[model samples]
Target: HKHLVQALRKAPQTAAVGFRQTVQKLAIVVELLLGDIPERAIFRQAPLRKALAPYFQLTQAVRLGNLQRFGEVLENFGPQFRTDHTFTLILRLRQNVIKTAIRSIGLSYSRISPKDIARKLGLDSAEDAEFIVAKAIRDGVIEATLDPEKG
Candidate 1:
């Protein structure tokens, strides 16, 4: 707590740095408190779940697929939040899923075949993946080329 206070004092104007630092400190505290407890025992503690609800709420805000909203949530509540490994994995997976969806639709980065895109995006339905691709094309976010013979 003393170190956090000192850090906050050192950079009073930078919200990003301050938020990250505070979250890291909170994570450390949580890890220390729950590290030795069995998973079953930890889950049985209803108060712990209640206390962590705000963190989960913020995570859901981040996963809403908007960078601005994510940044705002981080800036607003990051200081009071701590997340476990499961949450971290969920966040990472969400990011990857979005990236894959974007790239699969050919609206981001490199171009890829539709089949490959569907696989990368983990879409069970090729038609659904094609819908995404078609939407990107319609929105002028991506362009498709035809072979000379096909054209």
Candidate 2:
């Protein structure tokens, strides 16, 4: 438990591979934590159910490999998670679809058009995608410069 706290605190310093591996590890750890909880303690108790809902939801998201939902939970119930002593762990799992998309693009293309990037990332508009691409480049997530005229 103390190790988990340490790991979460250091997550921002972790690279993409580190983030992936940590999430996998935390998923298993969460499973173990859940397995240790006595079933009778939570059974048929409304307040207990409500209190445990976020944990259950987070576990489900990790189990189901739903990073989007995991991010949503962190975004929505951050305060609740903090009170429950799981906020740092949940907060460490920052799911950025754009970042994932950028990684995929870097692997597949040397130079990609903005509209295509938008389509791959599921953005509603190419302009938005272009903005994201420029931001990503500025942030060093993507190494290539955006070609506005070409895009």
Each prediction's number of clashing residue pairs: 0, 0
Error of 1 at 97 (Å): 4.9
User: Residue-wise lDDT of candidate 2 within 1-151, one digit each (tens)?
Assistant: 5565566456663355444344434543354344322233332344335545666666555544344676687777778767545566555443343454576687789877888877766568999888877787787776888776777
Tens-digit lDDT track of model 1 for 18-130: 35444443543333233211123332334345554544444443334343454455566555443433334333433433433454345554545555656666667656556
Off by over 4 Å in 2: 1-95
Q: Please report, in order, the local distance difference test score of every candidate based on alpha carbons.
A: 0.46, 0.59
List candidate 1 stretches off by more than 4 Å. Answer: 1-10, 13-113, 145-151
Write down the TM-score of every candidate: 0.30, 0.44
lDDT of 2 at 87: 67
> For candidate 1, which ten residues in a row score worst on lDDT?
34-43
Model 2, residue pairs in steric clash: none
